[model samples]
Target: MLPQRVRLQYEASVLHPDSLIGCGVRRIPEGSTERYTRWINTITQDQLTTQVYTSHGPTVVMPTWFCSRNWFQRVGPFDEGGKGVPEDLLFFYQSLRRGGGVARVDHCLLVYRYHEKAATHSVLEETIWNLRVDFLQERVLSQWESFTIWNAGKQGRKLYRCLSPANQRKVKAFCDVDENKIQKGFYTYEESKERPKPKIPVLHYKEASSPFIICVKLDMTGGVLEENLNSLQLREGADYFHFN
Candidate 1:
């Protein structure tokens, strides 16, 4: 497996020198991080970039990362900020900003171990959340003049609050299927210091416009969210980007 990984990495490097090439990873405890493992392994080639904003951090897991020395040097000096700093994710984002690409070998070549005392567990979720939000703003949100958020719920509202004032103003509305939230009509920015405050409307998904920043988690809604999203026939990366 190690030799195969090296061979594939070398071939990929020759083919895509400016890309971060990763291979599929199998978790040590078999089922540990099952969904995440499945996601890492199965995401389409385009999703390597499209899905980067998710809580999953890098679409390609860090452990399987293999890139040319020149590309690595160009994109990094991974934050030597010690523990709790997500150096891999920071580097991955930096590479993307530099116009680098992401590719995968599609063969499971590494054993990704999961342990309670792992360094990853030391990093606070808030730290990652803030970073993801920042990257989303830089890469996706800045391109849009205005957009709707897919959920009128907690995660969506949290994303709205995290946006800069300019970006906050760009949020046209919050869209959801929940009758209670839609009946309430709008989400008032109670924490905003603005005079009169901001009250963004909450509407049914079918009534909302795109492009959207979908804050809804995939799979958890038992296909309801997927069904709602597909019903609109909108394109990903352009019409919407998943932030959950």
Candidate 2:
């Protein structure tokens, strides 16, 4: 699935032919008799592809990884944090950063077993959040001059409050389809140390600007949000990005 000039690993267990599927590892428990984990579900190419950027995890388990020796050397070593660290994830991000490619084979090639003593459990949720945010800043926000946040709800506000000061200033406004949020007019940052704080304006989605940093999760709404987004005719990853 790799391009002629691009170095990539092809996975068949979960990818289309001639296309890279960042494969997902099937999670299992040690000494368990179940054929599949409770979470076992069909994974498609679209989900596998987006997981790298959106979820910031190894789309494929490390064991299924296959690449040329030279490419492996270029990608370099995994984090030696030993435990409580997502070394595979770290390496995958690095590979993407280095222009490495990823694809998945549409066949189950590995069984990833988990146990109470497994190191994966040691990684905290907050740690992953911080990493995802950092990666977002590095990969997307840095390239844009400014952007709007697509939601005026708690999640959008939280993202605004958590961003680095420099990135925080880049937020033009928050947009929403919710009438209540739009009627409120503004969001005041009570947590800011500035004497007057910051009161960010909230506007209807139609009036908002793009490129947008969408804080709204996909597939949760009953097509309303998607319809609104589609109406704008903006391109994803260029005119807008998703942080949800």
Candidate 3:
């Protein structure tokens, strides 16, 4: 049976004359692995927006997505990168980029079967990371004059190094709670050929500035990072964006 939530979301999405795309997802995964299920269920709004900038978070499979033919045609023709390509994510990102809106059914009306050898498993982690960074640069960083990167850890440092030189120059600092990182004081760009190279300061999260590009993964810090973020009273999207 089609849940009322799904029906209502569809109705509202299509009722609009302008272009719209919606994902009516069953958050619960049937017969999925515990690790996959846990990660899927724990996805947060910030992480979702950071990942795809969609309100419905990241849909693991296309079966969870529902949209009209017209809207689909407008944003359809999913990336033909084939096999290892994250076609669903790319399409969803494009739809949103073209002024689309997302709403979730939040009910288990569909079943998601997970197994080894799935097409999703074929995609490389680096491919996903590159796509997300590109999207973030195009959508968010382009508008900001300067920003900080949260977490001075490996992931955070990698993000800084990978950013375009123009964007890299805009990184004001790296912030983290790790005493070891904070004690190091600054991150030196050893690869740069500049006479002095470049030194970016590392400070405690409380002392760091925003709007920040958070590289810390969600649900992994036992709420320590979340608590610090909350204490700062910084609004997601505006004051910060997650890259992790």
Per-residue lDDT of model 2, residues 1-244, tens digit only: 2232123333331233322233334555554523222212243444444445444355555655766556567878879987778887788778778776666554444566666776777898677768878887888888888888889998899788878888887988999989999999999989998878888899998998899888876556876776888999976657776666
Residue 182 CA error for candidate 2 (Å)? 1.7
For candidate 2, the TM-score is 0.74
- The candidate, 1 or 3, that scores higher on lDDT is 1
Q: Over the stretch 9-105, how does candidate 1's per-residue lDDT look in tens digits?
A: 7798799999999998888898998878888899898888899999988988888888988998898799999999999889999999999999999
Badly placed stretches (over 4 Å) of model 3 are: 1-9, 15-61
| Candidate 1 deviant stretches above 4 angstroms | 1-3
Error of 3 at 205 (Å): 0.6
* lDDT, residue 116, model 1: 92
For residue 237, give model 1's deviation from the true position in Å.
0.5
Better of 1 and 2 by TM-score: 1
Candidate that scores best on lDDT: 1
Residues forming the 10-long window of minimal summed lDDT in candidate 3: 19-28
